[model samples]
Target: MNKMIALMLAASASALLAAAPAYAQDASYKSLTDKATADYKQAKVACDAHSGNAKKVCVEEAKVARAKAESDAVAQYRNTPRELGKARKDVANAEYDMAKAKCGDRTGTDKTTCMNDAKAAKTAALADANTGARAGTNVAQNPPATMKENCDAMDATAKAACMTRNAASSTKVAVEDSVITTKIKADLVKDNDLKALDVHVETVNGVVMLSGFVPSQAQVKKAADLARGVEGVTDVKNGLKVK
Candidate 1:
């Protein structure tokens, strides 16, 4: 009778063990379903709260969030992981769209500036994600290093020239900064009486080339010195001869 009781107890324990996984799986499915429902509700709320272009963006984000939540539910219900990564990528794309919408209108220089700022922010985020994916490993953020590895890298002089070109392109956008031009004129006219000499200031590549004639050497030097003192002026060429 003790032997039979022991056998019955063993069978009961085995049956409980066999049932545990299915119970846990059902619980997981319920949790995921709850979470998905919550996410869908939140997204709908967000969609209702926005308007205009922002409304469009909000709706897109909401859709992505809902999709991701649903995908998670499916994965949990089916005990599968295949579509989870794709859902994550869709969520990332949604985030990117939201970021772009935050940057506002891109019609002119403002748009270009906004896009550049957004690009920088995206690059930083990508770098952070890459680092996290690597589990605390460090990665270089420089693109030039990758270029050098891929191609026959230019010599130091050529590299310097390339840097100069890139800088020139950046500076070209700021060429419309009127403060620098105003300051250049103010310093040129300050202290020294410019009433007698017709002076004009022309800037090329940050080099101030003075081409007006002044009455005396003192006046010429004064003008050149003033031009040189202006911020952003690289060099002042004293092309003015004493009249």
Candidate 2:
């Protein structure tokens, strides 16, 4: 009975460890978002001096600035090459939007040429983003040496069992945690009221921890609620502080 209990505890611990997800612990997402917003506002204010097509172009430029800033922030927060690729693509689209807006100043064949040039630029940018995405898709690697070391002390049969369990657990945990984190971040960023950059997300097993600062208690609650609503999230520990 004692041996059985020990096995049960070991299995529990393994499950817990296996569910944990890896993430970037040091990225400052909030500060970047804030700076982006401030810069966009300043750019928009500068646009007030212009009129007609110039003002339209200026507004689109401001949008481009905001899009690029947020893209960079998201890429850093995710710390994944695929996400970085997507961010770059988003910037490209924003630039295309601004370019098309600028084309409004011309007429006849000049405007047509301008639009074609904008499309070509966007296409080139997307090609670059695709290359980045392909490069990042191979991020998965073999299980850590520690997992093998832990199994080495066991008898042959036990070692085989341990290795198998560790390998399966690691793969499952990584995939699950990554999906959960991505979904939660997407939800947070989409919410108009929530300052997503202000929050830090980490997952251990199926449990999520939200850390950092928000503007109000309501936002803290909202962030936690949003996290909890995501699939595969077993629980949420809200560590967000009111600023």
Candidate 3:
């Protein structure tokens, strides 16, 4: 029937509309991956212009940077917490490669120390990233019951005072959060290392949240580092996806 055909056409249109964003996202990430690949090739070629230890170091750095970029691109394409965690791990791995290569330039106890420090740094950064990933995976956990227990011990007048103070504390936290967010964003706009990042900055209870894409692993760390340097920021949680 004519009506049935019209309905079918409408359904097909609706399906296509629903799929548009996903398609666009896929296309965008494909472009990112292609550009990263081209850039990696150029960098690797530049490394060949050097010789000996310098060329070795350059080659290692190029490979590491490329790996990090690919991992980040894949994570952005997937846009999942698990993938993001993997990207962070890839960055740590790349850093380790650079560290090992740099250590190659040294000798004796200095080399040993450099290797040890590199391993420690890699371990710490990967552990931190995995900790966040685990937290994201299991959001439902035992919440402390201490708050209710303490409230039960309070008399009526004390309970009223506690409520008033808690309300005031929450308001103070909000004000501080807003101020810190503004300051951090302003500072980010100023710093050359961070200015081009255009990262999303948010704050809650003095903790800062950074989410967006940065050009490299260094910028990822700089995002959180810059936010933490702000006067009122209590902590920084980096959700910035690396390019």
Residue 99 displacement in candidate 3 (angstroms): 0.6
Q: Name the regions of candidate 1 deviating beyond 4 angstroms.
A: 1-34, 45-50, 60-91, 104-106, 134-243
For TM-score, the strongest prediction is 3
Candidate 1 whole-model C-alpha lDDT, 0 to 1: 0.55
Every model's TM-score:
0.34, 0.46, 0.62
- How high is the lDDT of residue 143 in model 3? 18
Full ranking by TM-score = 3, 2, 1
Candidate 1 per-residue lDDT, tens place, 1-243, comes to 999999999999999999999898888877876786687677778677778778775665565555555544543344222333344334444545544665564468866765565455445434433433343211121112322322238788777877776555544423522344457667665664764454544443355645433567888888887877777676775555443
Q: Cα deviation of 83 in candidate 2 (Å)?
A: 1.5
Using lDDT, give the best candidate's number. 2
State the lDDT of candidate 2 residue by residue for 121-226, as single tens digits. 6776677568657755222333334434488779999999987888776677557766887788789889998844445565545667575445678998999999
When sorted by lDDT, best at the front, the candidate numbers are 2, 3, 1
lDDT of 3 by residue, 39-152 (tens): 878998998899988888787777666766675565446545476567667767776776677778789998898788778767765875586567542111211223223445
